[model samples]
Target chain A: MHDSPDPGDRRDAVCVVGAGASGLTAVKNLLELGFQVDCYERETAVGGAWNWRHDRSPVYAGAHLISSRPLTEFPDFPMPDTWPDYPHHSQVLSYLERYAAHFRLGEHVWFGTEVVSAVPTGDGGWEVTTQSTGGGSSRTSRYAALVVANGHNWDPRRPTIPGEFRGRVMHSSAYKDPAVLRDRKVLVIGGGNTGCDLAVEAAQQARQVWHSTRRGYWYAPKYVLGRPADQVNDRLLKWRLPLRLRQWLYRRTVAMTTGDLTRFGLPEPDHQPYESHPIVNSQLPYYLGHGRITPVPDVTAFDGSAAELADGRRIEPDLVITATGYRPRFEFLAPELLDADEQGRPDLHLHTFARKHPTLAVIGLVQPDSGVFPLAHWQSVATARWLRLRLTDPARAAAVQQKESAKPLASWSKRRVVKTERHWFEVDHLDYLRSLESLLNEMEPA
Target chain B: MTAFDLLRFEDWTNPVPPADREVVSLLPEEDDGRPPLLFVPGLGHGAWAFAEHWLPHAAGRGFPAHALTPRPGGDLRAQVHDVVQTAASLPRQAVLIGHGVGALVVARALGRYPARAAVLAAPVLGGWSALGSALRANPGGTLPALVGGRLSLSARQLFQSGPPALTAEQITGYLSRLDPKPRAELLRRATPPRPVGDAPVLVIGSPDDRVVARPALDRAAAAYSGAPLMFPGMGHDLMLEASWAEPIDAILDWLTKQIK
Candidate 1:
């Protein structure tokens, strides 16, 4: 950890937005890195979506873990062995509470304080706009650096469908439990985990279900050889092999054991499999193998009681659910400050600091093939060191790095970055920890 | 009447309409010759709910009507206070008409205040009558949770949100003439206590109320020792349903004859 920030220098505070698993880790790292940090969360409690359930908000409707508990736990904390293979929503919340308490992060956090906006002051600092529900107060604060830790999923991406078929249509985000779907013939569009989960659950209640996907997608189970696929993949990614060979070997290994999409009713894809979805972690493939969920093709149109697929098959449905996906939205970020791709995901170099914005950094935006909690913690630690080096020993750091074969930590003002694909299939959690520690080590003055 | 019944009163306080200037002015200038009519709305409803339903009904009968909506804490005593406040503001005397949860409020008010008379239309009673009973029993204990959980899939609940379930045309017409206050103040009058005063009381029931349950409304009328007029096809939301005007006119005619 670097030298602690002067508590008296209130202006040196690093504001962490969101108190989710990622945000909490970021705050913990900032504290350990010797930076004064304050966390702002939109929810009244910690744990983000997990807290939504404990808070009993409707937003918690049907929350399931995309990543299993064993691989999902923080490095310092392990989940209780008594828990089932997959933890329930309540159990996940309990674990998040434990993580927060373990780090003593509650006092540093401002609950019910939503970060409405953050803009660069052009002086290498951030002006953060926040609304605090605790005392009905709205205020803006200046910070040395800002961490945008809010996760990018959960917001609904409305699908384009023909206007004629209107039974009762809502996004999967709006779906709570399947009780409201009793005796109804439902059509679930999208073969994503959410779509598949809803299809399987609804099949138990609804008279019939038609799950529509663009094409067949491979279903990877939560576990491989009695252990998590993530755990196995994590080890391979960290091995000392050529990046190209590793990518090829990773694909071959995944295909050998994971099997085909037919286990889930999806036909083989005609083209090479590249997921447009930033994150493709789901237990749907496992459910599909058990005949719990059925899959179909893309939807062409809907006419009242009937849905027409692109393949020319038509079926009657009493309800239609769109489990499409969510687009990344930086509603609170300044327009000029946003770095975005054609797909609307904020275009960030290394998926950390925005290419356009210097003092501003985004954490937990990547939907990693592995769990995000560990990645977010490492990113926060690297970021805290990056900020502290700029404030303290930039000249000495540049000279020391110029002498070493490995590149020195670049100044935030001069760093060049691009959006790198998250190599979840090849990542080891421990390898990532060591890599992040090395990056932090370089930032330290010799 | 049981001690529980004797302690209840009727509600006769009406709500302030929404911010619609046209509806505010549409209210006819107060007439000194006519007695005021106080309307108490049903559960999960506010004064705005009756803006179109009761507004025209009251106007057609040469009466000025106001609806009392539920507030955060709607119990029997709080309901009685609303009636007293409405009566003080309006003409000296007003006939109190409560429907569903509103009926319990009106009953509580009449037992406590000097109202002209009281009428409960399809008062929520029976095994499902836990709403009023729960409020009277535990005022501060998880009311939103109970109501939100139980009233899961009602038309009102669905339409209460964005774009509104009601037709856009209806909103443009009546929503402008509504006040948010009285409706904001009413709560679900959960159970019934008998009216304390010997005020004339009339209870109305419907055979088809899957939500309120017909047997529950029956027990309420039976407990009052009052004969309830039964409407075979009417459901819980009597005021908004078709053929409601006929039954409402019948009640008015009966009221006029009894008053004379």
Candidate 2:
């Protein structure tokens, strides 16, 4: 409740809004560039979505990386090769912890501190207000820039099924343990990664499991021929093979691995491969083949306790888990600053820089087919580089900004993924990373 | 990555898996604020080389000195990964000092880890340069090595100490500690990774070393954007000679300028 700016307020520092994977990387990169950074995390610790200890974390007990370690690790700080291809959630948390420790990122981070509000000061600086997560008077400070990395997966997006179900229903964010599904008839909705994962887990314990999806997805196995499939898949992507050839190869590979998912009584994909977010699940097919689970279409409506599907089928389930994805939420900054659409999803340049407010940017907003951390790393690197230019050479920075703002942001991939709420921030991992690398080259080539 | 880059890569599709590493250390009693020095050994060699003299000398001079050996398996990238990991495991940012095949590993590791500084001793760098030197030095030994056999080094092929203190018996004692059954490094054809992070480099080698020729030294130094600092009369095992303190002292002196 200061009538004037606090004596401690400083515009020389950059404020990073989270201490998760993206936030830690941002702080590290900024500090490496000699930028004074003050990172604030609402949680008591780091790891963001990967840390199940946080209330907003989505990681379940059995959560493991769908993206393999190589593509997932930071370009500079790679995961130890001794680790498995797909490390467990605990491994991811420790990795983030070690990264913070290695870079001394924790020194810059203010744990248990939440950014209350961020308002643009008239002179291209941010007046960021903060409060302790336990509730207290807000402390106001001024920062030259704000890097919002509060993650995109915590805010659950629930699908609105008509009518009310008497049975227990929960979002995938709330499905943290399999003990809840022990003998219950579980209907896992949405054929996304989370949905497929929950479905497979349910088959091991549930009395009967029904997987419901709006449309079929290309179920890529976690592994292909004893190697992590993401690494194997990148062979074609790295080769930059024509899309048709790549798709044919992917189809052949998937066909060989999982065979036709439709043969398991699941709906076939309506769109071409790469048109939807890939669902990596090797066990779904196995469970389906073993007759432990049933596949159904979208839930049309819920009548009493019965769930009616799009295909006129009815399933009475004890527990209905919605694996529908999440929407990005940035409450501290005003919506207009992000150039956000009606859905509150950001329209960031390369899923990072803000076109409208140059001082306001977001990192790790992207959902890449591969792992999200390395993309976050590169995004943080780009953000740091751009910020350095703004501080050292304002003229060149403004010129670059002008050009970037005028280019009319294009889809991250050559071919656009289906325009859906879930694909709001989806990107072709290779294509987007290549673009970021090229941009970095243009900015300050290594 | 271009096709040339792809060919140079072990496998862009299936990256060489990183391997385990064993590090031998000799720490100073007090921290002098100098960066740690990590010693990467030559092919068929282990950490025992640097652990013998350089590690103890560097530590005595108030630097955290350590030496690493790639756990006797995996490809060249794995070797590089082992070095990078060892550097990271050090207490502070490390000054990577690689000898022979390890110099090549350090060159590639520069593409990944950003060491504070680098030092290459009698580096096996350029493909043709290394091959030409190896064939000329001992064609009979080089023939079996090309087909994946260990290119065993003769006592003379390794040691050429000019100092009176370095007796022939002492040279053989040093060689005795080496892994006798170690495989020959045939990765001289590996693409030289571009020096990254702007770390200053020091290439110290001997023109008299029969294992690596002067051309290889020049190529390694130029690739890292540095000049070769020649120490004549020494052999490939720079740290195993009677003048072992010379190269480590030179490196320590360079660190004093570049670091503190």
Best by DockQ: 2
| DockQ, each predicted model | 0.00, 0.27
lDDT tens readout by residue for model 2, B1-260: 11111111123256666655678988899986778888888876888888878999999999888898867666676777777767665555678888987888887887777677888889877656666776887787667767878665666667774553477777677666666333344543556665544568899999888888877788777776678988888887888877788888998999889875
TM-score of chain B of 2: 0.87
Least well predicted 10-residue stretch by lDDT in candidate 1 chain A: A411-420
lDDT of 2 by residue, A251-343 (tens): 998777678878888777888888888788889889999999899988999999899989898889989999998888888878888888898
Assess the local accuracy of residue A115 in candidate 1 as a C-alpha lDDT between 0 and 100: 82
Where in model 2 is the C-alpha error above 4 Å?
Answer: A1-6, A9-11, A311-313, A402-411, B1-12, B18-20, B26-36, B59-64, B71-75, B88-94, B127-160, B176-191, B195-236, B249-260
lDDT for position A165 in model 2: 95
Per-residue lDDT for B1-260 in model 1, tens only?
32311100011012121121111111445563455677787565566656656666766676677776655444445555555455434533467788766776776666444355677887754323444443443344425545443222233211222221345554344334332222322344344554532456778866655445556666777777777787766555566554557557766776776556
TM-scores of chain A across the candidates, in order, are 0.80, 0.96
DockQ of 2: 0.27
Candidate 1 local lDDT, A373-420, one digit each (tens): 756766776777677776788785455335432432232112121223
